[model samples]
Target: MVNGEFYRRYLNLPDPYGQQETSFTMLFEFREFEGKMYLKYQREEDTYNLFNKTTNAIILKQSFMKELFVNNVLPHQTHAPDATMNMNRSVEGQAKPYNEAFWKYYNAPVETARDSQILKALSEMESKP
Candidate 1:
């Protein structure tokens, strides 16, 4: 939801390409006030300038996962308990902190669950075009 993390993660994942180096790189950027996220694909040098931006801006709370998966922008995963939780947390703004103040409220298991969820999601999505 924030900065199209799901989309970017799916694209950059090391697979399907058969160890082939990517011709382009991707990143996510959040625009909180707009309640939307941007998925940016930056290509190599001037040659890349010829391409147009395939920007996807969507509501922060919306699930762009299905659409992304269909468009090959996201990998499909049926067992992403962690990712599901993380996504829910992110939507609710109850996520474990990544900053210094995180430990004050979060426990190890919570973090582990979140990580596991993300990993499972990624693994399921490893199959790509």
Candidate 2:
């Protein structure tokens, strides 16, 4: 939840003074290999903040889930002569023509409801005379 007010109301708690809500998060995973630590990935989440609610029974209206398992280790290279670099890339912004091999091998996340809406809108726009 962006604003803590919703949760506070649900939990029957008073609002905190000057509490600014954040809609950003980052997750990281690391592994140790050859007595050295290497980061798997540091990713920023893309969020759609629209919520459709109902007052009845529980229903699976929307969901996003991902399960990952890494058994084989990747090539760990270092930019520095002595430093070890695990992974390198921009966390956000436009996709660049970099790491073609890695990007080719990478599988994108499953399309969400928001993604479907966007695609449909684009298709409709393109169909306009």
Candidate that scores best on lDDT? 2
TM-score of each: 0.15, 0.29
- CA lDDT, every prediction? 0.36, 0.48
Tell me the TM-score of model 2. 0.29
**What lDDT, from 0 to 1, does candidate 2 have?**
0.48
Position 94, candidate 2: lDDT: 28
Local accuracy of candidate 1 as per-residue lDDT tens digits, 1-129: 246532222223232221211133333433332343434222221111121124332212211211111112333445545644443333326544578776676655555788999988898899654
For model 2, residues 65-122, the per-residue Cα lDDT tens digits are 3323345665564444433322243322324468978887588788999999999999
Clashing pairs in 2: none
